[model samples]
Target: MRVNAKSQKPKTPKGFIGPIGFDLPSIMPIVFAIIVFFSAVSYSYTTVNEKNNVLDSIESSIKIADILKGNSYLFFDATDSGAKNKFASNCEKAVNIAQSKNINFAATFVKLDSSSSIEWLIENKESEIDSCTTADGKHLCWCGFSPKKFDSNLSKQFWSISFPVTVDVKPPGSGPEDIYPQSYLRKIIVVVWK
Candidate 1:
């Protein structure tokens, strides 16, 4: 028997089915949620990277301050005139390095004789020097930064603390009236916003 063409149904092609459809309202929320999740992740990553960079800069500043302390000792040990000159040159070299690296520092060499001089040095330089104290009429040479400004977010996020170094000196004489030649090196570092 011949099949009737008028009653024949069309056949669907294999492997040509379209994507399944869902209600737009139901699918939109999921898509939006995925987008929001990715956005939050990207933002968090960028923030972490920025904080790490700030931390690295602060660490570098501290290391540079320590290097300056070592140079100060070398300066103190140079007794000969020529050696002293060389020491000064070395100090300049260290200073250049610090500047090149964007590390800020201030240094002073003080010879303690009387309480007046010690007080004077402390009064004039306390903001920069982390600490200054007098003992046996000897003054301390201190190197440090004046004021520090840091990233507020990083500071709060990491719970960081400030710890600075201070150098002390001992005088040869016993009384405040006598002068002393002994001195020591001190270092301090502060992280501030530029």
Candidate 2:
């Protein structure tokens, strides 16, 4: 049952050849609708990706801060020079973990200070917006704000609300005593972004 190729024409895919080829007004609305649909999908995809990235950063930062709580020195003896040094080292560890996970974050130890050098909170300002001008007189300051952002554009989108978390560890009796000599409530605020 051999057939001659020249006798039969090649078949075209189903939608390629309409009865009326390229009808302008009739097809315009359909083309416009397809374009609009694709554009909307593309926009939604990018938006979702950006939001997911931001959330990833926040989660990574929180994890880093939580890791610090497991260690006692940062919270218990914040005023002690040794404890302060340990806290700084822990912050570095957080940064390293962020780098490995491709997240940008700044974690800090914040404590309340009655004598902060920052202008006293405005009368109408939220109570959480207090200053820490002399906290420990050393490693940390500015109350609960995040460190300055490395990129200006990124900074615009930073999630920077400070909240206090529990630090159950007690200050070591052997830590520097004259430097406050007692434990104060503290917060480990972690601001993360992609």
Candidate 3:
């Protein structure tokens, strides 16, 4: 008996279109929709992860700064040897606090000396910084780094703040003119990474 092989159905390749209810054009939109949906989901997931990473780094840095700020601030005497010791102790405390939380850190104060020269001093320095007070450079301006030096910092998320050091939080005023003038300011810089 001879078989009519012409009437047999042919197999469709895995990725090729097969004879179905409609042509490929009708199904193209569904395929495109699935692709777009997945792409959107992936993009959103990545964006959220990046934002969380930045937020975490910044929050940790703030915690570290708060540790230092709370211990000894607003009274940073750049010219006094005793004050220098206190600053160093505070720096050690800040570093330890940060280290305990698994965060690497370094902090220093940069101020103008008696001769109008910049003094780059760290926490554990024994410099007889002459009375920097009368020389219009008595404020405590600080710079900090986390995970690495400022120049070698690899993290994209970081924060830096510099303002005149004041004994009062708001300068004891309520009017706009009473607002504190930005002069002889103290600088504080902080950076973080994941």
Candidate 4:
């Protein structure tokens, strides 16, 4: 018996004709995958950038607090409760320091377990809000510029920190026993904003 063989043409879908016609379907998955990958990458980049900004603000606030605490002019004597004649000058220096670092600074000396509070600010419009005052009308022995914002804009990144500090309070003197100074623990609140 003689063998006979015939080859048949591959079938093509209707209207599918051209050299690149079949390539579109094959390339679609690749194109879709690229779009998905890029979208994910872009989203991750934005999230990371936002987080970094927040972290930088937090770090700068901490640094400002440390600088204020270490400033000899501002906290001249941890034992001396009374402000020196140059105390205002020292606070201005602190504000200048914070401004140099591109941030705003504010400090509140709050007496523990008492309504007495002292605000250290630059005495500007923004600082006029009386952040240290309580709803019960906090008593202020001294309310003046100490720490301050570098800019007039109040809307910005802000952080606050409070720590304990010892201060010597001079009692009213009339007799020999009034000469001794009383020590009190005060809370120093440091606020930093950019």
Candidate 3 lDDT, 38-66, residue by residue in tens: 99999999999988866766676777666
Total residue pair clashes for candidate 1: 2
TM-scores for every candidate against the unseen true structure: 0.40, 0.54, 0.50, 0.49
Per-model tally of clashing residue pairs = 2, 0, 5, 2
Query: What is the full ranking by TM-score, best candidate first?
Result: 2, 3, 4, 1
Predicted structure with the largest lDDT when compared to the true one? 2
Q: Residues 75-95, candidate 1, lDDT per residue (tens digit)?
A: 222122233233335446556
Off by over 4 Å in 3: 1-17, 20-26, 71-84, 111-155, 162-185
TM-score of 2: 0.54
Off by over 4 Å in 2: 1-22, 71-85, 112-154, 161-180
* Cα lDDT listed for each candidate: 0.43, 0.50, 0.46, 0.49
Give the best candidate by TM-score: 2
What shift in Å separates residue 15 of candidate 1 from its native position after superposition? 32
Error of 1 at 39 (Å): 3.3
The segments of candidate 4 whose C-alpha lies over 4 angstroms from its true place after superposition are 1-21, 71-90, 111-157, 168-183
- Comparing 2 with 3 on TM-score, the higher-scoring candidate is 2
